[model samples]
Target: MRARKTTMLALTAGALTAGLAAGVAAPATATTSVLVKPGKARPGQNVTLQVPECETDGFATSDAFAGSAALDGAEEVEGRAGLATIGAHTPPGTYQILAHCGDVNAVGQIVVLPGTAPSPRPTPHGAADAGFGGGAGGVNVVLLGAGGVLLAGAAVARSRRRDDVTA
Candidate 1:
């Protein structure tokens, strides 16, 4: 009986090892490819990343920007791809965009151009010539006062109607 028990244990161990080896020998089935459009953009521009060979149902992908910003989107279908918007304040430089599909990963680079300088705002017309107290808080105060008067008038009318009905 002791010998039989030992043999059974050894057979079980051997079977488990064989099963693990078979699993390891099998090739992985998850394959993917990634692509990016226009490869270069400026801050505030939209960048599209395509994963043509992703899973049919969907897969999660992420974009790593300048090694700091990380954006994630899903690949819903074969042709449909992920998208990430370059931040408006992203500095002008070369940045990387990474797309991950299961164990496969792809990377692309983007060059951001320095945006044009903002035009200086023209000085407003003379304060008296401008509307609403030179675009200050005067208009807001006047509107608030008018609203308060209308509310008070409504309350007075409602109270008078109630008093007449009661009488």
Candidate 2:
């Protein structure tokens, strides 16, 4: 039993030493690289961006709408991973992706075509001038009030009999 134990210990040590000597050991520093998957997509389509996991690592996007590259927003990196999703909104052309790891950075590309136009806009209705919340209340209320006042004045005049006036 003692010899078996010694042999197992010796084998474990030998394996670890061999790994270190062959430079197959784990790296002390991580590889700094950024990659985009399924990077190409049509307009109004979405693509995934992979970023290095960092506390402040996030993503940005650009569009032809601005005639320049633009960034959408940044998201929190979770558990050694950072990612972003971008939609193809720029005019049909090649697009660039910029991946960031805190201060570190990477870039990716995609082709966006005028694959489809936006859905049609709904038709607009003419202004309603005969309803509430319109200027209708102002005109209607003032007219009704004036008519009532005039009616009351006529009724009072008829009710009263003026005494005969001497000229």
The prediction achieving the highest lDDT against the true structure is: 1
Residues 1-167, candidate 1, lDDT per residue (tens digit)? 99999999999999999999998997555444456666776666666667665443233333324223222445454543755666667777776655555445555676766783244478876445445444533457678799899999999999999999999
Clashing pairs in 1: none
lDDT of 2 by residue, 1-167 (tens): 99999999999999999988877554343334445555555555445455544335345444522222222235543322433333544567776655544544555566666675355578877665667665543457787799899999988776664532321
- Candidate 1 RMSD to the real structure: 13.3
Cα lDDT, all candidates: 0.61, 0.53
Give the clashing pairs for model 2: 61-70, 61-71, 61-72, 62-70
Instruction: Name the runs in model 2 displaced over 4 angstroms.
Output: 1-33, 53-55, 64-89, 117-167
Could you tell me the TM-score of candidate 1?
Answer: 0.39
lDDT of 2 at 89: 49
